[model samples]
Target: MTPSEYGFLKQFLKSRSGLVLSDEKQYLVESRLVPVTRRTGHKNLSALIADLGPRGSEDLKNTVVEAMTTNESFFFRDKTPFDHFRNTMLPNLLEGRRSQKRIRIWCAAASTGQEPYSLGMCLQEDRHKTAGFRFEILGTDISTEVLEKARTGVYSQFEVQRGLPIQMLLKYFTQQGELWQVSPELRAMVQWRKLNLLENFSHLGTYDIIYCRNVLIYFDQDTKRDVLQRLAKQIPEDGYLVLGAAETVVGLSDAFEPVPQHRGLYRPRKQGAAASPRLGSAFPTLKAMNS
Candidate 1:
């Protein structure tokens, strides 16, 4: 692609979805957009770009944005966070919200449903503790294609193999030919919807926990700070925020501080405390878990 063409496509993606693409990602753009070109009957990326003008079809623009959004996910990704949730976070939240008897969780960028489903399973395991609590899991993503798949709660054998414990799989999934379907009980626990991190989230109510995960890596620092600030507003004082093991809120936003002894866990910065300095440096031990 020529310089002008590359710049146009990069800026367009950034404006639409907050996806920051650098010059080195030119090959990635070509590879990802080739199918868009073919489907739209454009000869190449240039033609596709040329057609995406002020008069462009909304559907066409959405298609391009969706095509570029990464949707990689699997069951119980990065065992540590789930471990913390099951052992620490959930129990704490359960006790704190005992009076209210309600628990709400938002899993941002919940591609293919695994992350939220995993949380559902965790809740199931601890059902005895949450006997009377009402649990709600909302999984949101920018890609409608993945949201549809997530709602179906069906996965191929290969998808099940990744990060999914065999025991949990047997307990929660029913084999259907080559694919494994999440049990009705578990599937019913999660609600999936289309959400853009760049857009207003005031319509979505506050949550006791929010999992924004690996999605922030695609944005520039400004976008990251803005997104984190917005997310902070949706979390209550004692609520938790989980980012990808490789992502952080340290330099980006002071709205959150790393949870002590938790790899990828964070909470809203305390009201009267100083912001944690260089908190991202403390996450070296956490590995990237975006599979």
Candidate 2:
């Protein structure tokens, strides 16, 4: 791809999805969009971008965006977050919401459904603890293709093997010829939708917890602050926000403060305290969320 084409595509992706593609990612752009080029009958990435000019078809734009968006995920992708949820966060949330007896969780960038399903499995294990409480899990992603796959709750043997324990696999999934399908009960526990973090989230209502792990790394600093601020508005003061271990609100926004002893956990900052520069102190062994 020429520099002009690369620049145009980069700007387009940033405007649409807040994805920051640096010069080093040119090969990544070329590799990811090759299928799009062939499917759209374009000669190359340059041709494809040219055809998708100003006032491009919404379908075409969506195709480009989905192709570029990374959807790497697996069941319980990071064990610590789920463990923390089960041991610490859920109990506290349950006690706090005793009068309401209701809980809502939003799994943003919920690629192919693994993270939310993992949370669902944890909730299923402790159903007795939440006997009278109602729980809602909402999974949202930028790609409709992944959302459809998530809705189907079907996975290849390899996909199921990743981070899914054998006992839970036997209990929660049934063999559908070669692939495994998540149980109807687990599938029924979550809802999937297409949501861009750059857009308004007010329609999704407030949530007791939000799992937006592994997503912020793609955004630039300004976009990160903007997205975090928007997320802060949607979460109650007592609600929690979970990010990828590598991501932090340190220099991004003052809306959230690190949850002590939790590597990737955060809560809305108190009304009067100034934001801390020590946000990075919470997670000393930070690594990429997918790694």
Candidate 3:
């Protein structure tokens, strides 16, 4: 790809989805988008790019980003955080929010929906305890393609093997040749949508917990700060915000404090509260890891 061509693609991506394609990623552009090129009936990426130029082609633009975004996830991704959520966070929130009888969660950057479904799987175990309470798990991502797959709740054997426990796999997923389909009930408890985190954060309603995990590392610092600020407004006063083990809100934004109970877990805090978002910084990270 010509430097001008590469620069155009980079700016296009950054503007549309906040994903920065480093110069080293020129090969990535060639490798990943060649299929898109073929599917669009273009013989080459240069031809595709020429046809794409300012043509009011929102669909084509969407296709490019979808082709580029990563979709990596699994059941009970990291054991400890879910364990903390089940043993403490959920229980504590259940008691604290008894008056509301509602527990809301958002898995931001929920590529292909495994994280929210994981939460739903756990919630199913305690469904009876919160019978009257409304529990909702919403999953959102920028890639329409991944969101569609997530909605279907099916996974390949390789996808299932990534951190999925054998017992839960047997319990929640039905096998069909090489694919594993998550149980209908578990799939039903979560909602999925295509969301771009770099833009305005409204439209996603407030939540008791927002799991943004590993998605933000790809963004620039200003984007990160702006996103964190926008996210602060969506989480309730006592709500928690979970990020990857390598991520934190410190020096990024002044909206949340780290919850010491679970490492790398965060909760809403007053503005200017120092290092509020406590991170044990352990692993299996906030869902599918960036590493």
Candidate 4:
């Protein structure tokens, strides 16, 4: 692809999906979109991109965006976030929301269901403690292809072996041919939807916890701040936000502040509040929560 075409693609992806491609990523773009060129019957990447110029169909644009969106995920991709969910987040929400007995979690950019499924498993294991509560997990992604796979709740042996424990896998999944499928009950716990973080999502309502891990690392600084601030609006003051270990709100937005001693955990900043609200009443220390 020419430098101009590559530049246009960079801007196009950023505008459509908040994906920032640096100058050195030209090869990456060619690698990912070449198949798209072939699928669209275009002779080359340049021809595929030319069609996107003045009269690009929304269908073509969406197809390109989905093709470029990464959907890499496995059960409990990183261990610490799930550890917090099982120990601190769950117990706290269980106590804080006792009157309502309902807790909603939004897994933004939740590619192929592993993270949400992991949470579902956590809730299932604590079923004895959460006798009267309702847990709603919404898993969303910009890619419909991944969402379809996630809805099936089926994983290949390699996918399952990535981060899933043997005991949990045996208890929650049944072998189907060479693949394993999540139990019907566990599959039902999560609702799947196609969502683009760059678009308005207020209609989805607020959540007690939002797991938006590993997605912001792809966004530019301005996009990161915009998305983070928007996310803050969907969380109540008592709610929490979990980000990827590599992402943080420190230099981005003050709408959230990191939970003391917790690396990837954050809580919404109450407007006009002088000091951060105390979580002692709701979110206990990890050690205390675990004990």
Which runs of model 3 end up more than 4 angstroms from their true locations?
271-291
| Worst 10 contiguous positions by lDDT, candidate 2 | 277-286
How many residue pairs clash in model 2?
Answer: 0
**Worst 10-residue lDDT window, candidate 1:** 282-291
Give each model's whole-structure lDDT: 0.87, 0.88, 0.80, 0.88
**Residue 218 CA error for candidate 3 (Å)?**
0.5
State the lDDT of candidate 4 residue by residue for 1-291, as single tens digits.
888899899999999999999899888888989999888899999888988866888888988999889888998777778777766777777878989999999999889999999889878876888899988999999998899999999899999998888888899999999999999999999999999999999999999999999999999899999999999999987889999999999999989988877779999886686335333333333234223
Error of 4 at 261 (Å): 1.1
Error of 4 at 190 (Å): 0.5
Model 4: lDDT equals 0.88
**Which residue pairs clash in candidate 2?**
none
Q: Regarding lDDT, does 1 or 4 come out ahead?
A: 4
* Reference-based TM-score, model 1: 0.92
What lDDT does candidate 4 reach at residue 244? 92
lDDT of 3 by residue, 1-291 (tens): 789988998988888888877899999888999999889988888887776678748898899888888776776666666765666567767877899999999999899888888888777766776678889899999998888899999899998888776777888889999999999988888988778998776877799888888888888888889899999999887777888777889999868777765776777776554434323222233333222
Candidate 2 vs candidate 3: the lDDT winner is 2
